[model samples]
Target: MDRKGFSRRQFLQMMASSTAAAIAASAMPLTTLAQDSMSYNEAPMLADLVASGNLPPVQERIPANPRVVTPPEEIGQYGGTLRRAFKGISDRWGPTKLNEEMAIEWDIPDPDTVNVVANYISEWVQNDDATEFTFTLREGLKWSDGHPFTTVDVQFWYDWYYMGDLADRPTPITIAGEPMELEVVDELSWTVRFPAPNPLLPLAIAKLTLGSWAGPTMAAPAHYLSQYIPDLTTDQSLIDAAMEENGVDTWQQLFGDGGTPQGQIAGWWFNPDLPVINAWKSVNHPSNDPWLAERNPYYHAVDPEGNQLPYIDGMTHAWFDDNAVFDLWIAQGEIDAHIRHVASANFTFYKENEAAGDYTVLLWRAAETQAFYPNISHKDPVLREIFNDARFREALSISINRQELNDLVYEGLFEPRQASPVSGSPNYDPEFETRWTEYDPDRANALLDEMGLELVDGVRMRPDGEPLSFTILFQSALAQRGDEVNLVESYWEALGLQVNQELVERTLYQERTDNGDVDVGVWSADRNSVVMADVSRYTAEQADGPWAPLYGAWWANSPRAQEEPPADHPIREIWRLWEATLVEPDEATRNALFKEMLDIHKEHPYMIGTVGEGPVPFIKKNNVGNILGGNIWDDTLRSPGGVASVTWFFRS
Candidate 1:
């Protein structure tokens, strides 16, 4: 049984004992004794009644806020066609990038281009409290097959695609940590009851509406998938037959299975003839040339100008493997837009080409970039002991002169920052900003002494008689940073710290990190939205497999914390506070609780933050306003930081 049920049983047992003691204390006549004896036997039964339903409730403070609604004025309307380039993604229309691109085109409502994507649902908030939330379907929305969009479409999406309980088809039931929950309130309206009252719900919803946490997730036309869902349930071999036809082992593998491959058939766009529910529907594709997208006539949203959206007629996406070749493409105006910049290191090419009057280069400072973190899960106890020393960590941070590295290595284009997961936003604490570790070998040596690390025979060893050497598994494709790695090696060597850098292929590097096999490594954490608490979900320990991105020295209650948490400590407290927030009716209390959560996160330095960079898109001269630029956030959808594709226009 659950916690409540067990508590009730214990309370009943205590009451039974108290009643029996009272009956024994009351002296009675001999005749009354017989009646008293009989009553005594039944007294135990009375306690059973209390255990059944008489127990007092577990009280909690509920949140005061209700749901929220977004005003119509936040919606934007205009027209423009944007041309983008395709990255080396496995499948262009897979649930990953395609959904994001599609959502950008028409799915979300108001968008903050730098950080996140907004969905169609609009919410209203008064101060920190949500008053009401209203979801209006894209009025004229329709399926690619020309079926009218309605509440049924939303219901079908949750029932089939998400929940998948109506049909017996095997599904990807779990992701990150929790099983996705789906409940429909009614047609044209559905409410997500946060497990607790969350003060940041509005901000979270705003991010979601932008499609940061969620992608377009096109409301699947149940008319099409329904036929297949039932067939798979009715015939046991139907799933097998489909897998064989697609030459894949499982449906999940069709989406790359956490590894990149040359090709995969994962979406409707994979078929040149199939119709897709994207703002800019695909019209043509050629291997050596740009792909095209025509405006969908049945598009859902009406522009502010009272016209159908998708201001531009269509788009062309050119794919290039070489950075220099892409620069040339932009300079020569051969490609419509280079949506991603690959040659930031070759700023000379950008500066010289732009100065010579080929095209303008919009350089963006990517928010989430490089930082080193110790893999606490390394199997060696000796290495673990060395890493456990905070002094050692502080020493390492100081050893690497980030300012010098940015200047010498990146040619003064990057920013220096303390390693933290939430560095770019208002959540970043200025008080928490510690000074950059000075490039003093003496200071590094002093900190090493404090940690009991000593140099013996040209190797640093712990005072506990443990060796102080570790290997860093780095990505081998960093051919551009061969000099930087050499410089890092030299710095560590000065302190008699043996740092080994093992370069592995990109795939291998990603696999090791996923599998928790690396010792020390550098990685990037993109900015994400905490409105739904989705980004922070996997940060804590899961009931099952794999650690979250926030798993590191900074998580206070983590197994690696200096002061291990009690059984019901910070995390459990957060859960309880979160639960209370759900039922709370007071706005001030809810906001206070949210601030508390933010405070806790700030205190815990989960991911050593680096620089705030932007995802800069290189647009062609003809597509001047086509580029999207903003500080690179941990969560790409929530903090995309620029205009949603709705405002783009093709300059004549």
Candidate 2:
């Protein structure tokens, strides 16, 4: 496959020239430029607050140069709550994806291209070698509580939280295993200097899991968090009182309590007091039956007509413990707009009831429905040796009938392919997508026989004269995962292998994977579109993915790393290639380095990919305006956030 899309270097260069102009003419307003000439508008709810002297005027609240969002359909009215549904407290990503605000964000102008644009920050400039980045905050920008957001907040987050006691959280940008140095340029600007060139820093900041408000390098409200920190606070008695109230012995534990900065900031849905820069601020905790978030009066962005966003007055998230109940609610027109947790199996029921429910069902593309990870680094030495063999992994991949799984599980709506990049991605390869994805049980049996595994009484026996058996560990949160694994269990059992499926809670599932106790890990292959931004699946860089959790811990230099790969391990070469790709400034050279790393995965089927590029149903009420359909549903783009949910509203 020929590489066709712009690399990070090319994209940054274009941003410096033509793209910069387009941004300025559209969303990226210059902070230095005054907006005094234009008359600003506000929602009636906020206008009443201003009239009552509880809030500042619309012009005073918004930044001097507010980001402009052009509505997809038309200018939206502002008086209704955007109703949605969530599973439980553990489902933080559900709301985080919809409301996350970052310093920078990915701008997908079209399906094939992704460009980085300033979001919370007004603008940014990268040095020639990409060693340093200077970010200038939007002038007059304020947090949800109306506190001025400046370089001080960034400094507090970096120095006090990140580099200080909360060092367990991974640093967002690092080069040569060293953290970047932050330099305070001014009240509104700061610079981050790395020891070596870090070309992927921009994209790293735009990734949902890495750089959003709830991510590791989070932007802390210094004024509010200072009260909890003993070093920052003048009163020792207050710290003692807080610690005692929270029933913790140390100040660190108290500072991380439910109501404090760390706990609430990371889990914003649970605490309404946490200051945020997102369009909406939580007014009620998630524990409430229907959690609510009111519009942030001081939100930085505005519509093209100078009306402050979000066009909707507020948002309400109803809780449901079961997927069936959630689907039934959607069928009853109870949800205004939602993307996550809508089951593909309920597509027919949703479509049949759409007209009666007065809602529209829009299908977006999912990167992949499910990908199986055989634990090559399993604790059991015998199973580990067998799993590490390339032929065994290949046999496992070819044994499953992907077409049958797609038909029975997804109603033949998804594409049956091996785990690879999205079809139109620059790194995508046709051969990689179709390799070893055939339903050939005879070939699988032959491969098993070649491995000296004899079938006795319809059960395969291990080399150690024991029954060859393994368990598939998956989370119970997603119903589709259970269905996928059940079919896989049947297929493997048919091949005379003992297979067991254990569905655990999300927390226990993570605990098991991190401890390297799971025989197999089941998860959806998200972040497939932008492989470079997050290479955890391909390379054992982090435990975010299921493959080689212990190896990833060692790669991350975490204290919890129980096992490390030998010096000559192939993953070491992958790490080297990725590190080189980070510093390589030339677009072509950087891409080539990525291709080399991907080639390693192609040769070794580390993560067995099943069907992908399937439709994800997004339900929207008829009254909801400015909601765009047909977008890619990947964690990298952050789903509805990539589509800009701030501009959505109810048409009165």
Candidate 3:
């Protein structure tokens, strides 16, 4: 495969060098010279606060060794509010992705390679066996509220949230069926020791652990959260009073419920009082019409010129329930810089109105915009047996006219392929992408006939004399999904089968799929570029995917699991391969294991792909600087986060 006329190997090599340079630059101190020798500049708003004696000086607010961000184009002028839109309070990711201050992050200096780089943490040291990792925090890092951030926060997170009962064990820190042990080394340092080799821990941290809000081991503000923890607080009445004020019967409910003020404080998105380390801190709750986030005065990053980062003053995310309203907002140039919910079908509309909107339309690479999954572990035994058959899956695969769907729904901007790794991925293969993706009605019919299920009254009949029928369950809020599902419904309906399309609310859809109530599930096959980082779509290890929800629940040890797979099940092999990849220290060996797992998906149409590697339109206002186009859109890399929006500024 080629990218911008360069061969895959050549592109990867180029990206490696560039990624290394970016990572090196990111690790540099805030100033080019010594911290004491250099003069730091602050945003005008912060300067005003300082003049009024309301805030500390810039130098005091910033860390001793703040992370430096090299702007893409030029150093920016600070102060304009970056306007954008969100669905509602539930649209946490819209803001979270913009300011996902992970301890480490996946940096794509170029389009082809992803390198792990330090973000919240300063640097880390890993043992030869990869079982132990020592992380050091920046010397003078402070939370948004001017409280020192230290290993104490890490300890609090580990003890109260991880080891205690606040949350479940996050998969990233677990190895050999045990959670990794956390050892606080010093005020600014800590160590994480695993039972088995965990070379992929850094990658997992970058992918899964976005921030303190992501949960335990990532570290929360101990200074603030301690007030809520009953054991940590000196006064037991404080907890009782807080719970009573929040109208919660239990202390746990007051601390964990999103509706409660304390719970919202923990999330750092809904409470302005919450102290965050992100470039921006919430100024108002998301429940508000236009949720606002102001620049954190203590943001621990600077440009090469020593200007505290986040050149923009703040962010305003206007709430909207409908995608049509969002599209209108984009068309009218209400959004400054965005990529999250941009629809591929609106490519032409965006391009046509680029001049009027005062924004530039950029097409980024999406892994898989649309993929269908037939539930092999359906509630009906007969349907489950039919879906479990490889031949039956292949029929479902080949029967879909992907090209038509691409043209009709995506405006011919996406590639017609099966669900596999994107071409940019190291594990990408042509066979894996094109496997059984032919539009063949005759073949589909023949496969059903071979299984002795005859076509009766223009509909396929099951062994139990019932009509072969299934509902395609999808989230109604998802952009372009209904249109894609409609086309898929038509394609499958043409194969002498009853196809019902159900577009439910997002939460309802997730609940139905998790309970294995849906016959078919529809979602984007994201994380395609780095498939190994997340294999939910390919295997039954995550209940979110539709293919085998019960099997996934069992594998994940979720309470919702009704039954476990038998020893001879193909899914068990996938589970084995995934477990091996987790502990494999050698990169090449781990990648090979991941490839072997992908090979299984190629043989079995677990998640059937229709259109993928599509162009995702990113709308950037003309005045927005440091907005990079053509980046890979994947949840693992966290698109806008990888783009480093902290350095994004307004030209004015």
- Per lDDT, the best of the predicted structures is 3
* Cα RMSDs, all models: 20.9, 5.2, 3.6
Whole-model alpha-carbon lDDT for candidate 3: 0.76
lDDT of 2 by residue, 214-332 (tens): 53234677887677787788988876876675577777664453223345433466558777788887888776878888888999898778888898888888888778888888888
Per-residue lDDT tens digits of candidate 3, residues 123-175? 87888888999988887889999999889888877776677746546566777
lDDT at residue 339 of model 1 (Cα atoms)? 36
Which one is best on TM-score?
3
* Candidate 2 Cα deviation (angstroms), residue 374: 1.1
lDDT of 1 by residue, 1-652 (tens): 1111113233224323322222122111111011112111111222343357542111100001101112223332234444455533321421223223222221122222222223332221232333233344433345444565455665665564444533211111122223334445554454433323333333333333221112333244455444345433565465456568669766434322322111132244443333345545656543435665665544443333333344455666666554556667656555544434434555555545553444555433343445555654445557655654556666776677767777776665555665432333333344443433356678888889877777898788856676677776666434445556666677778888888888766556656665556667655444322222333432333201112222422332232222223454344455545445444557567546655664543454333433423223344453355443322223333323223453344544
Model 2, runs deviating above 4 Å: 1-33, 109-113, 168-172, 208-212, 215-218, 237-249, 253-262, 541-544, 558-562
Residue 24, candidate 1: alpha-carbon lDDT: 25
Better of 2 and 3 by lDDT: 3
lDDT of every model, 2 decimals: 0.43, 0.74, 0.76
Order the candidates by TM-score, highest first — what do you get? 3, 2, 1
